[model samples]
Target: MDHQQLLSLLRQMTLDEKVAQLLQLATPFFKGADDAGMITGPMASLGVTEREVRNAGSVLGLSGAQQVIDIQTNHLKHNRLGIPLLVMSDIVHGFKTIFPIPLAIGCSWDMALAERSAEIAAREAAVSGVHVTYAPMVDLVRDPRWGRVMESTGEDPYLNNLFARAFVRGFQGQDLAGDTDRVAACVKHFAAYGAAEAGRDYNTVDLSERLLREFYLPAYKAALDEGCEMVMTSFNTIDGIPASGNAWLMRKLLREEWGFDGILISDWGAVKELIPHGVAEDEAEAAYKAIRAGVDIEMMTPCYVHHLAELVRSGRVDERLVDEAVLRILQLKSKLGLFERPLRGADPEREREIVFCEAHRSSARELAVKSCVLLQNDNEVLPLAGTGKIALIGPFAQSGDILGAWSWQGAKEDAVTLRDGLAAAGLDASRLIVAEGCGVDAPATEAQLAAAIEAAGEADAVVLALGEHAWMSGEASCRADIRLPEAQLALIAALKPLGKPTVAVLFNGRPLDLHGVADQVDAVLEAWFPGSAGGAAVADLLLGKASPSGRLAMSFPHAVGQVPVYYNAYNTGRPNVPTAPDHYVSKYLDIPNEPRYPFGYGLGYTTFAYEAPRLSAAELRADGELTVSVRVTNAGRRTGEETVQLYVRDVAGDVVRPVKELKDYRKLVLAPGESAEVSFTITEPQLRYYHADLTFASDPGEFIVYVGPNSRDTAEARFRLTSTV
Candidate 1:
């Protein structure tokens, strides 16, 4: 309890206990109050009595460890200054060994397996007592009609700032106040809320503060430069205010230009949603504009427990802003020692021997086999054969709902499904044949399409298992037709006239519109919502015992009017050049401007190639650095894992840039006919950006650099930066 004992417990709390420590509320308002304690359900019209439910301080969502040790042992038996509460939840992507959804852990460009799935979801939410984990939602999404783009980690801002510093160093582990198996990582919808407008979830986001500091504030400033101890605030509205009231985005750019002295809070109920975002004229002017726009808590709102102690006793708010938000919530409950262990990592026998054990389901089956992406295989119809006869048809073939949609303690009866991963891979239960064939978007009747076309005309391989319905993709689940579900496309047009072979898999959560199930599948994959050992990592990547090294961290659009299609866009002024095929360029007269799967596409059951980008220098300067290289190889006969990527582009940019951008990548692995090389140093702060007077820098010209395996088949070269420090 330092900082002079948290400023002597914030000079003994009371302006209604420091406005009930900025108010949070939930866990059924301290489990359905009323023995004159009053606070009933839905926070009883927000007039919450019983002294703001015995000084709220924090609770939201709530978790287990003896239900947060019986709500901090009944709020320390209503004692006036004990202060323990805290709790928090929505442990995005697994609190019970589920993994694979942060856009399939950003298609496994594995940042150390996304920091070991955020350190095994901060050790199963710190033994189920959860001390904050709104989670690594580093919103940079290029709109997949924003149903929380499966809790973002895609459309690259340098790959969502490297999975937002690998989920804030795997949920604040390097000592988030001395980690008891860590948890305090709240980096969320703060700034751009994934540019909502029309991609729509909470709506309005206008952008251009140089595209919100070059692409949605670099994964929330790389999860507050990886120290992440909470941030939240974002129900949308940015350039016209609302990110929980905005004050130049939370007090002049997050506490005086990004110094972010942690704990901000507010997203659910977004402080009485500033009166439906017409910018408040109620709940005491949205609790005086979210505590003068710095919002330290206020989650399920009561507009800061009904107008923060009458706006701090009518001085128009400022009891030193409620003693600096109760001294950053008692300096985060004295850096979570919580006045010395108020059930810190609450045990319950370590939450039943660590939630889903087996070394967290073997790191959720090795991050669901590097988050399965394969995309399409064609004449080489995937590895399948474990003595075929297969045909596991639709409705997630023996569904366990594959844990998507903010898992919330995952456990569709301890998930595993595709017929329990092909009977744990030995396969033969009379050669498999499964078949729910209908419902992931309803309609399959004609006797479930003649028993899925007579079990794909008596199987010799079918696999199918379709998509969407873990409530069709996270938060408010968007999708204005993100395709694939006309009764799983009529059970894939009644098993594509049973010619056999098939494969598909899918199970989505955004980035779909797979041009009608990629022309009736010969292979496909794209397993986005694979969690809880997603059907034993899709039967070990369909019997080859694993390989499809994921990839496509967002960009599948073949159509949904290409709603914000991305692979680093911006190249117009009449550009669609096929040596100038014209009707005034930027083409799209009915399809084909690219992307049906691009941004670092994916494929791996062996095939690499590459070799054409070289350049150890053609000029760099401003504290020089250059490098480049390429090589690649595997070229087929098995062993895989590629990634490569790189990107760049500048050539003439006092402002119009992104015709390419990613910047750096690597991944590799290889083997058959082996090869390697790879390189990429480049420096000058990877050609800095944010210009148009926002001044991030880097100009003196000519860049190019490509080197690919994905952003639309690359291979270029050419250098030059030569100035701008």
Candidate 2:
């Protein structure tokens, strides 16, 4: 259908029908009642009748080919205009053949792998009848206490923006209208959901407009620029208003300024939440506010279904607003060719063939290996000898709960345990001594601790697989104390006395406070919830079958008090000097200001040495580009991949600037004894920042460019920007 046809369909919709199009219902609403033909489940409390349910434009959190086909088929039977129901679900990481969580994927610093993961997710979801994936959550996260940080890429705006684009491209592909394997991408938590106060879920976010535009908003904008089909409003309040009802943010900024004509859907129950946010009096007012603010669909809520029609009839909301939203919905349906084929890409045969297939699992295993970060390898304890008896201890040693949260379709039983991975990698079963040291968060019994110690004593070396349980992170699972449980710490203490070389393999969702664990273990591998193939990947890295190339996408804080520690923090008036006295400075009395591990910090089997940065010119014109180059050599015997990062700091600015901001980075594969000159072209736009007045332009000033392996340690050079054209 073309624009004219979509408009014609919208003109024919009644007030109730049009309002229903803006409401998304769950699957139970359409499923016929058991025995008797009465409608059942949670649909009654929604205040929606049978006709309203049939008229609902979309279904949330429902998949499976036959299920979707039956739902759409039943809805079309009762509908007057024969509009197909859109099926949407949370395909954040993967559908069935799960990959590592988004945070783990971010650590890879491999955009191509990120894109491939999204593509695999899309293919699997599309076959199962899912039309849109609420994914590529681009919120910039600094506080690990926020459970949803597992969904975001990381703290750096530049890195988040890159991954955002990659996810969108991979999900929607080049042409969403024609691609059968691709599912529409919904870039979500629209504004600044990641900046929740105290890192609590659904908390208020109070940020200066300058900071908002400079940091939080870039990734969302990048996703939109990449042609994501939908945007989900965050549950948090931006400034003083909830994002679902913020007209300035949704209409003026997203629609007018960003020119995002795509569909805007409210997060789950966010429409009714407007009343609690103090922005709306009741459901009626909430519907009016969200509709006026340009929300197209209200997910898992009755606000739009219960009050939108009444508001329209009372003249509180213009019927044209309803028409405009319905048109966007119809347009998407047309783009998806839903009217032509109600089942779209839903095929039972395809679903069976693609879900958890070997090829997809292979990709997952490879990417999982790339996502594991080698945080510490003191005395070269890693690359464990395969011939020796190895002790695999800790709760995750044989646990299959390696799949992180938000992977609703992934089953824990299908996961590869570390012991299984070791065996698959050709390690002799008799040589692998496994013990459940303790439960993920539960206390270990004396017998359990004794058994773990004995196993460690018998083995040549110990591989401690420790981390938070799968339920510890994701939505509504925030942790005030982001540290390993006391039980795990006790297990480590018990094993530390064994006098054996121990490797700490962390399987967590967020950056943890490893102050104690780091000292006890000879090697530390930060594996942020590797998915189905996590075990295989861990085994590969352990036996030197693969190199650890992943980096820290988020900074690992030294302690819980440093909740918001990041590399690109602002320089205060009294900055702490490392070599000078700590009096009257921005310093912590108990600990240093630096993080346990800085952003982009990771180690592989090999080592890299960086030469001092060099600039092609001392100064650059506004229209010209300056070339900055650095020579990096693999200083160790083995080959490895290195992420050479380029960061810039403005000497002076109209607004206070971060101490350093990542601008560009290149991940290079280097052979031992070989060196390569990595060059980055710096243009005037790279130096531009949002000023106090909200003007996004660069001011002529001196800038320092740093080239390094990680943010904390770098080689620097000076340059100048002449003017802004």
Candidate 3:
């Protein structure tokens, strides 16, 4: 059906039916036809009637084609108009063949690989009967204390925007109207949920409109402009109003100004949360406020079902709101070709053939390899030679917690262990010794410690695999202290006495403080929850079968006190100088202002040399573009990949500006001692930033251009922008 046909369908729906289109329930609610207890179990707790269930527009957290077929068939039998249900899931990283977390993937600095990961995820999900995925969470994050930072690309809006567009293109494809393998993409936690105060989850957000427009809003806008089909409202309040019911954020800014006509949904239970947020009086008021704010769908909430119809009929809520929302949902279904084929893309045979296939796993392995950042490799202890006994210690040495969180369909049992990868890489098993040094966060007994000491003493070198448990870093899992658990630190401290050329392979979700590990270990390999193929990826990097190419998207702090440290931070009025710790500056007496490892910082077997940048013109016209060029050379004997980053700093602005902001980047694959000259074309639009009044424009002033492998240690040149207008 087309737009007019959808409008006609809306005209035929009863007020209750129209209201029900805004409601989404879980998979259990749809099993009532076969399981009689669903009515008394999930339905009772949900406070939804059987009539609402039949009329409900969508379902969440449901997988498998056969189950979707059964539920859709049963629903059509009960509904008057036979409208199909839109099935959505949290298929963030992968469906069955999981990839690295978004933060880890961002470290790869390869947008093409990022898109391929999303494409594989969407293909597996579409065949398994998922219609939409809440993915490409484009919130600009700086606080590592926020657990969901693992879901974001990084702290910079420019980088996050690139990822946002890529994920959307990968999920939706070029023509979602024709492709059954692609699912609709939903950019989530709309607006700045990432800037929660103290890095707490679902905490209130209060920022100037300037900062919101400049930093937090660009990635979301980029996703929507890239043809994302939906937007999920954040749980936090902005400008003292909950985002689910903030008209200025939803209707005025997202809809009226930005021209987004796609579906706007609430995060789970966020619509009814307006009451606790102290914005709504009751469920009826919540329904009125959400619809008024232009929210089209309410996930896991009955407020829309119980109160929307009554509110609309009583003239308290406009009926057009319901009609517009239902039409958008219908348009999505029609775009998916669901009206013609209600069981669209649901094929059990395809699901069996595609999910967890070798082709998908190969892609996952490739991404995981590129995503592992070699943080430290002093004395070149890695690429272990078959010379002597090697001891592999710690909890994750053989653990299968490689598939990180939000791998809804990924099998932990199938994940390749670090031991498995090392063996597969042709390591002599006779010379390899393995032991559980300690639990991830639990102290080992005296006997366990003694056994670990014996294993290390017998070995020539040691590899300690350590990290936070897989459960430590998804939604609502925020930690006030972002460091390794005491038990793991104790294990590190215990092993420090051996003085072996130790390599610590970390498997974590967020960038950690690395207090005991980084300082103690000879080499630190940040193998962030490497998903199904994580072990193989780590093995390849360690054994020099593949070079480590991943960079840091988010910064690793020197201490937990530097929770929100990032590369593109503002130059404070009283900037801290490393030479003057006692000066009256913005300095911490105990810790430095800089991060332990700055953004874009990573390592490989080979070293890189960056020449000073050269500008095309000393003075750039406001309407013209400026080209900055630099030659990067592989200075080591090993072949490697280098990500040449371009950054700019406005010397002065109307308001405060960041010390440096990422403008463009290039990733080059070079043979040993090869050289490549990379160039970036900087446009006036690229130089623009939001002022205090929230006007997006560029200033005619001096700008410094820096080119390097990472955010820090860059070679710089100067240029000036002149306005012709």
Among the numbered candidates, top lDDT falls to 2
In candidate 3, which residue ranges exceed 4 Å CA deviation?
A: 32-39, 579-582
lDDT ranking of the models:
2, 3, 1
lDDT of 1 by residue, 517-578 (tens): 88977888888788888898888888889888888888888888877888888988888887
TM-score of each: 0.37, 0.98, 0.98
lDDT of 1 at 149: 93
Q: Could you give me the TM-score of model 3 versus the true structure?
A: 0.98
- True-vs-predicted CA distance for residue 632, candidate 1, Å: 9.2
> How well does candidate 1 match the true structure in TM-score terms?
0.37
Of 1 and 2, the candidate ranking higher by TM-score: 2
Steric clash pairs (candidate 2): none
Compared with the true structure, model 2 gives a TM-score of 0.98
Clashing pairs in 3: none
lDDT of 3 by residue, 29-83 (tens): 8863344455578777879988898999999888888888888889889989989
In candidate 1, list every pair of residues with a backbone clash: 417-420
Q: Each candidate's lDDT (Cα)?
A: 0.83, 0.91, 0.90
Candidate 2 or 3, higher lDDT? 2
